[model samples]
Target: MRIATGGIAQETNTFQREPTTLADFERPGFGVVARGEEILDLEGTGTVYGGVVAEAKALGVELVPTTYGGVMPGGRVARSAFDTLRDEILVALRAALPVDGVLLVLHGAMALEDHDDGEGLLLDAVRDLVGPDVPIVAPLDLHTNLSDAMMAGADAFVGYKEYPHVDMPRTGARALQILAATVRGQARPVMAHARLPLIAPNQSMVTTWQSPLKIAIDRAREIEREPGVLAATVLGGFPFADVPFAGVATIVVTDDDPPLARRLADELATICWDRRAEFAVRPVPVDDAIAEAMAAPPGSVYVLADIADSGASGTAGDGTVILAGLIAAGARSAAVAQIMDREAVAACIAAGVGSTVTLAIGGRHDNLHGPPVRVTGAVRSIHEGGFALAGPMGAGTRSSRGRTVVLEIGGPGGIEVQLTEVRGHPHDLNYFRAFGIEPTERRILVLKSAAHFRAAFEPIATKVIEVDAPGISSANLANFDYRALRRPIHPLDAGARWSPGA
Candidate 1:
């Protein structure tokens, strides 16, 4: 049996300042943009693409090559770039005709310039090319925004079960397993969805495997043990995407049973919604959080999570509200993981390490994440940033910070800020250790991530306090002027109500 696979993946934040372009995908820093059997090289690793390879090889099936392009989290993908990659995947699939099945790897929450339903649009195009007979299965990010059109196009969908998404490879493996079963005429997979009017804040969507989400996922797993059920997926939609389909969703795939799939999906979605309040979060104000960090006990580190400027959520990593507050409160033994400002890094490099410099770092991108704070500091160190991941979040993966500088702000504040040439989320401790700074030894470690940092920094943190700073990915969705989201959604609209469609 032969299976064709490859795709373009990106989680679009419509509000982000920078436009996602073709160049971004070609050199994504962390991973290479692959083509042809080049996709085979990505297999059997920790990534989702690797899992797809594992399954095909295990089944001893021929895996056809297709192009794959992915970009980091940012604004709506430029139509030209989207077209270039979309056409590449479609054309490749068209040329690979006569395959037994197809496996698509996509970030389900993607939004292109004209089409907000990116995965749905891509799936529709693939379906049209392949016709109705070819069994198509895809594994999606847990942060997928489910759409009706997407459901119409694909035979089944496999969504990641973990946040920080350690389960990517397993999800991909599962997708191929189903595709193989279908090819052998063993299991007829029928997919159904129970959509919810919920856009959960990233902070509340933690799957320590013990939250309300855990209860729903556990029940779904239990149901998967049933004879007819194939898979059940609960996706916490990305709120940064201002689209009608952007909301929490439950997808269930059953073997030759539509009614059972719908029923299980409905049950899973209801359980998640009933515990919706547990997902609501109120962040501590920046000034207060800074003050608390200052007063923290000796030998303790306060993990200050500045989620508003979360690089993972497609926000510029130049937020200064928390840093400004820390300076005003005269902080000590503090270090902020990163501020992405190429200009600032260049200025520091020009000044040279160990030289005293008066610099205004950050706030160059936009006004949403606060203005650049003026600090007179000495350049502590400089490096061409590259680090290897330790685990939980992209374990064993390599990430780059580009050209980086550590600024040791003078005076009583004693704040150290890391400035990078590029904007990448600080999900792992490598962001700090790679630059010669010890994260655990610091008094206050400011992380520009939501829940992902918890994978590495949580265990050692005396207390983790989320700060409600200013940025595109703010926890308070009400802060943004939303134009495209469907009216009266949860948390946004207090009286919002929803029931699954029949």
Candidate 2:
């Protein structure tokens, strides 16, 4: 069987000031094509293609590759950019005519200026091109804002089960398996979608231990074991997106079992509503968090999350709330990865390693979080920061820190600070290794992220504490001056109650 594969993935934040452009796609890498006669080793952050190639090799299926484009999460996608990608994929599908099936990896929460349901629009266009008979399987992020149109257009859909998205390979495998089955005439797939009323807070929606998500995931696994059920997905919709379908969703794929799928989806949605309250998170004050961290044991590492400036939520990742707290607390042996300042990086490079120079770090993009903190520190190490993942997420994925420089600051009260220019989150151990800063050796490690840090840091941390810092994706829903979000959603609308059919 010949299978066609491609992807266009990005989680758009409508409120972000910058729009995702064609340049952004090309800058981060864009469009890889690998066909049947080629045996290329797909590595690095090329996760979608990596999994697709792996699955095709295992199944002994001939593969036809198309263009794949992805960008970091940011503002609404430009209309022209969306058109370029959509047209490219549609053209590829038409070119690869009579193909057995199509597999796509999509970030299901994409919002374009002209289209709110970007994934659905792509799927519909593909369905129109391929005709109704061809099986189309898609793997999506768990944070997708699933739409009814998407459910109607695709034959089968699966989403990452883990929030940190450690399950990308598994989701890809499932999509391929379903597609293979459909190609072999072994199964006929139908999809059902359930929209939940509640909107989960980004911080509280961590799937590692939180309720609603935990229960919902467990129930989904249980239902997947039932006959006729091919896949079950619970999408914790992207809250930052202002689209109409912005909320939690439960989707099930089965073979001619619409009734059973609907019943199971409703059951899952009911559980989501029941556990809605548990997903509400109260932010801890930056000063309080610092005090707590400072007072903790010597070996303990405190994780202070500046959620609002979280790179995952389309912020600039330059917030200074936690940095200010650290400065005020006069804590020692603390390390913060990636403040994303070009000027600071240049100065550090010019000054050379071990040179004591005064520099301003953070607060350049977001004034709402706090002003930048001025500190005099020695340039600890300057390197062209590069590291390969040592964990589950593309173990061989190589990421650059973009001319990184680490500044070690000595405060008035003997605190040590390591500031970097890398904008990526402190999600992996490699992030530290890239800078020659060993996290295991530090007394305190501060990461500007929501949750992904747990997978790498949890094992070595004597104790992990999540400090709520200010930025765009804050735990406090009221902090954002939201103009477009639908009313009566959780936390924002305290008295809202939702039933399955309501």
Model 2, 1-502: lDDT tens digits are 9888776788887767778887676652112223233213562233655676777778988777666677767778888888887787778778889899999778899988878888988888888888898889999888899887888888989988886777787788789889998999998888888887667767666777755687788889988999999999898888887777887889888888888888888888888888888878776777887787788877676666666666777766677778777777777877877677778888888999878898788778657556888988888778776666777555555665567777777732244444444466677887787777778877677776777777777777776666677766666666666666667777678767777656
What's model 1's TM-score? 0.96
The C-alpha TM-scores of every prediction are: 0.96, 0.93
Clashes of each: 0, 3
lDDT of 1 by residue, 1-502 (tens): 9899988789999898577888888764643578997888877567887788887888898899798887778888888988888899888988989899999889898898888988888898888889999999999888888889889988999888877777889999999999999999999999889877777887777776376676787888888898898889988889888988887899999999988998889989999888887777799998889888888788889999999898888888899888888888888999998899898899999999898988888888888889988888989999987778775667656777789999998543388899998788877778888888888888999998877788778787898898988888787877778788987888788877866553
- The C-alpha stretches of model 2 lying farther than 4 A from their native spots are 28-40, 43-46, 411-422
lDDT against the true structure, each candidate: 0.85, 0.75
